[model samples]
Target: MTAMMDREAFEAALRQIGAERYHHLHPFQQMLQNGQLSREQVQAWALNRYYYQSQIPVKDSHILARLQTTELRREWRQRIIDHDGQEASEGQPAQRGGIEKWIALTDGVGLDRAYVESGAGILPGTRFAVDAYVHFVQEKTLLEAIASSLTELFSPNVIGTRVRGMLEHYDFISRETLAYFDKRPVQAKRDSDFALEYCLENARRPEEQEAVLNALRFKCHVLWAQLDALCFAYVAPGLTPADAWQPGTAEKENPRS
Candidate 1:
């Protein structure tokens, strides 16, 4: 059995995994933040990324159902609300949610709302990656499921970089279009702090500790694989997979050049 590292050591080691393997390191991301991708490539990114964002609540809901404590569920349910928004009354305006914000981003990029919502146009890799995350939460042990969310620890930095880069470079991307990200840094910090503390407290055995680490590593793979598919199909070889979204296929006509 692996000797258990001290709590500080364990936390530092997990942070190292994010530092080394997170998708922010991927070439696709570099091109994205560096302002090197074409409008079409940027369109592909926004369209595909929506699939991931939309699944977040589904995955969180799965984990939420399995939590045993009222306090835990209270904490977890906010994540679902953050993405899905609160229940609205008839004739009242809806509370803006992350999913709606993501739709705004796709629209700003000239994608048809119907096409993006239907998700028929996204890459195969996107569906597979997002679906796998939902399944992992449903199937894994409670501790492991919570540990997977540790990806949130690294997200603020990535979100900061993405928002800044896109605003500076893409004419179509703006503070308004990227409003989905504006609140996420605070949300992510709160979520990751809770998740990390949960893992450190619950994972008493060395093997369980390893499971927590591996869970975070698997999440990093899920994120990195999505980008790998995007880079392969959209950026380099320039071959979008069969049945995936093609530029200008939006239900509404794209007004951009």
Candidate 2:
């Protein structure tokens, strides 16, 4: 049987996971901040990352569906609204949601929405890692699923750094283009706070605590690997996957072609 754990120690373990594995350490992110990538590489990144952006609310909704309390559901539902928008009134086009805003980012970077949404340009590692996250949430214990979200514990600072660095270094990217991030720090805070509390409260055994911490570590790896693949394929001379998106080429217009 798994040993029981104290809450404080478990919390410490989760923080340690963040300290070691978060994508803030990724060389690609560093190069990006340092102005090393070409315009095309940056465009490819924004295009591929649209898949991750689109997946966020789906993951949140799956996690939200498992929470039993009305109050908890209330807390979690805001995440959906943040990504999907409130809905259309009778007259106006449906208010633009986070996904739409993300499309704006891709458009700003010169990627076609069809190509980005098709996910043709995304790294294989990105697809695998993101799929792992969704599967983890659906298959793991609720406490562990919540724990996986604790990556946001470390996200605000990184997001701040990214926004400032991208704005200062990249001439092609503008504040309006990066608006998707503007509300993320705040949203990440609210969501992570709730998830952290859930994990700390429910992870009552040493083994259980460790499991949750490891879940967070797994999620960190998921984020880190995406950047690693991007660096290898886009920044370095080679390593692009066979099926990966090649910038500057349009998708074939004919269905059979």
Q: TM-score each candidate.
A: 0.95, 0.90
Per-residue lDDT of model 2, residues 35-77, tens digit only: 7878778876787778888898889889899999999889888
Which candidate has the top score in lDDT?
1
Native-to-model Cα distance after best TM-score fit, residue 57 in candidate 1, in Å? 0.6
TM-score of 2: 0.90
Candidate 1 lDDT, tens digit per residue, 137-173? 9998999999999999999989989889988998877
After superposition, the stretches of candidate 1 with alpha carbons farther than 4 Å from their true spots are 87-94, 254-257
For model 2, where is the 10-residue window of minimal lDDT? 248-257
Clashing pairs in 2: 4-205, 4-206, 5-205, 5-206, 121-245
- Residue 67 error, candidate 1, Å: 0.5
Instruction: Name the lDDT value of residue 188 in candidate 2.
Output: 87
